[model samples]
Target chain A: MIRKWSIALLGWGAILGLLAPMLHTIWVSFSPDSFLTPPTNVWSVKWYLAYFGDRRWIHATSQSLLIAGMAALLAVAASAPAAWSLGKLTVARQRLLSILLLLPALIPPAALGFGLLPLVYFTGLWGTSLGLVLVHATVGLPIAFLIIRTCLPAKLGELEAAAAGLGANRWEVLRRVTLPLLTPVLLAAGIAVFVLSLNESLVSIFLATPTNETLPAVIWPQLRYSPSPMVAVASCVTALLGMIGMLIVIGILGYQRGRLIAKNTTAINS
Target chain B: MQRISSWLPVFASVALVCGVVMAPLLLLLRVSLYEPATGRGFYTPGTFTFANYAIFADSHVLGIAGFTVLCGVAVATMVLAIAYPLGLFLCSLPPRAQSIAVGLILVPKTAGLLAMLFGLQRWLPRGMLATIIAEVYLVLPYSVIVIYIQLLNLDPTLRDAARGLGASPWQVFRRVTLPLSLPGIRLAFQFGLMWGLGAFLGPLFLGGPSETTLAVELHRQAFEYGRWPLAATEAVGLLIVVSIAAWGVPTVAQLRKVAHS
Candidate 1:
């Protein structure tokens, strides 16, 4: 009895530990206090308002959104054809490409980010949204690939075959059959990639300059030099974005199907 | 001709992706071979030198590398230990409750890591312990998920058979459940160690000055000092360390089978 009970206890304890910081941050964000303390009594959204009111904050948030949006879209665009192509390759060749696709995730992100830094710099694309978008889209490719490939139902092959039998040409079958089934998954992959890109921090830090600070970039310096309650608000905004992304992804895949497909996908902790 | 035509686009896409990823590593090697930056710019831009690689000889740089490995081992160990009980506890739950528990884990997980770290600093003293704790938060969700999935895949009859043979609960867990979930445990450790080796934002914002990992210092050298050569040197060092530790990635080998199947 004690042993089973102890297992339950430890499990819940881990959950509490996992949640405490986020829960506490949420509590602190609600504080009306001018500084960085949790509320004693009254809670307010003044900090959130203050955050929204600031031009720099708005601009940075917009930049983060722009980078994530563009990156996610790029990943989606590249992956469909690439994943389709992957299906055509020899098994060994497909495995090699799969590993290659996921290589960015496997590497030390610092190594990954810094390697891109020189590429960005020498290309004179430093502090450019396009540069960051390219980097993020590259990083996001695997997750996008994984989701799309997994979600590419086997029925797709059957449907394509039927279309071919009916005399639909290659492009015609792809246009009519492969694309229709793919539309929903591509949409979900885009959202997944978007969330991953927005939440990405380490690479953003190295690549972002004053001219192109994403929200994480904005939050980075404040963390070291000038900490504040409004920063908490900014953090909350990002937390909120992550929350919405999760709900949207869940909504798209539907709970049961998402769970089923996600079995192979794992958590993309980017 | 038809076969060749179909193969072309697939090869093109794969080549593009491989080039993007591999180009950086190759670039890092090329850049690291350049002279250390002078007043002119990030580097001399035309000169060759190996002086930057000499940083690995410095005790301070070596310490940072050692600390990174230590942190990785520690985080991976703790995450794996926690995952076992969490996995079983999750199994004991009803279906609806299981999903809720998963949501609890997933919410904090997908919630921006930086945001969680910021909140963590306020909640705990902002330093190494806090950084490790935040990493635990960073990794624990997936570890639980991995372990739970592995546990779910177990043949319940095997465990029951052990229990029916008069084995104690602990004995059954030790002999049957633990051995069976070995793959999950290994995977969870791999996940933890991979992030731990490359642990960046945790030590960056949450950790103390002494806790600087190569990633943090790479940022400092490159951006703070405009020392691109040095940053590239450290990037190469980081890769070497990761590849060394990554030998244990049975997951990659596992994925190879899954990809083809």
Candidate 2:
């Protein structure tokens, strides 16, 4: 019907509008000129080469990877146990606790950055990787919690109870039963946490120092005023890492869903 | 013993929340009451005062809070408007098509906020318009997902039954679909508003000085001016306002549910 077509038209129009900036970023990053401008008469990898040729950009990239990795590990460690225990709660309790865990995300992250700026200085971790890692973990924990919690099987208690009834002790149940079941969920949460921390800008603006500066911190200043292709190149690399992270998430989630469907169909057939 | 043992694992999450999040927040609250340094440190380390909050009483500071709230509301409304059609359309598609639609839509958000904003800063014009547009873009993905998930949960049988009963499509939507998805739409609006309040990157990266929200002001005070006490004041103020605004959210949605039924 005409209505359906019009609605589709509107939806697609909105999607295109939303995508405009990212597309522009990609286009601008490839600008053949040393300085960035629109109406790209040509395309070149000069910026990409420039990024590779520069020591600071490469150092920033490695620093970002190291920080993101450590943060993700810490986040998943905290998130997995929390998610499993939350799944054991009654629905009402579970909902309330999840919201409590999510409170860090709901508030302005500027608040966290402001708070951490002084705390880190006091703790003697100011501008250190240790400081950024701890802060990133705190910020990424809510998302990591949500990811693992959602991906967890609904019958978590039933499964754990079944294991315990079969003579597994608490530690045994956790080690032998709970962790295996949680592997994929933990993986998903870990990657999600890593990607978020990698592209993180807000807290990094406050925390990053000369030695510990991440790609976003490096990209931040260069983005101001008249940006060059080098800035675009850095942005493009960060953007690409984000897309790669999304693909990994989709693959893991899809595989999990596919397995669940297969199990359901097999049960029906048998 | 069993109940106590069962609670042991939950303690890790509780510890992380309390230790990493709440402790620093509490510390910030304490720091807000400190005497700001005139000559030496981030603040006078131990001296306590209410002077930072006194600055908040000034009309200039109050204007920033008011402007921030207005921006949040504007971004929320605009994001919801754009998101509704996409949510409806995505939910209408078949499973594979639905996934494709979602995947396509996530491209901007998945590219990450910093990169996307860098692009937006270049493409969009400056000032409040650019800030709003970028915030809307930053928020649209989440809003659409909220609405789509809500709409997907509706019973298609109700729509078919409405058509069978001789209601027009518009009537069916107004009578059935609209009523059912009102909760989702409300949730989307609230979610957008919460995120808009937290719209630090968009405004920071793209907006002019006149577009200074409370979040940006907090950043300016802390980093730019080295006024930790003033920044902590802005942070605490932002938290109180968001909590107060959010209190009315569930009630409005609940009232809508009653009215529709």
RMSD for all candidates, in order, please. 5.8, 2.8
Q: Which pairs clash in model 1?
A: none
lDDT by residue (B1-261, candidate 1, tens digit) is 998776665564465456556887899999999997668788888889898899999999999988888888888888888877888899988876776677677776665666677777877776779778767777778788889988998999998899999999889989999877878887788878887888887787778888888888888898789888888999899888778777756664576588799
Worst lDDT run of 10 residues, candidate 2 chain B, spans B106-115
- Reference contacts reproduced by model 2: 0.63
lDDT of 1 by residue, A146-204 (tens): 88887776656766787789789999988877776677788888888888787788788
lDDT per residue for candidate 2 within B46-70, as digits (tens), equals 7988878987789989988987898
Give the DockQ of candidate 2.
Answer: 0.64
Tens digit per residue, CA lDDT, model 2, A6-88 = 87788777777777777787887777886657545678877888899899999999999899999999989987777877856
Q: Please give each candidate's TM-score.
A: 0.88, 0.93
Candidate 2 lDDT score at position B253 = 54
How many angstroms is residue B4 displaced in model 2 relative to the true structure, after the best TM-score fit?
3.5
Give the distance in Å from residue B112's predicted Cα in candidate 1 to where it truly belongs: 2.6
- The best candidate by DockQ is 2
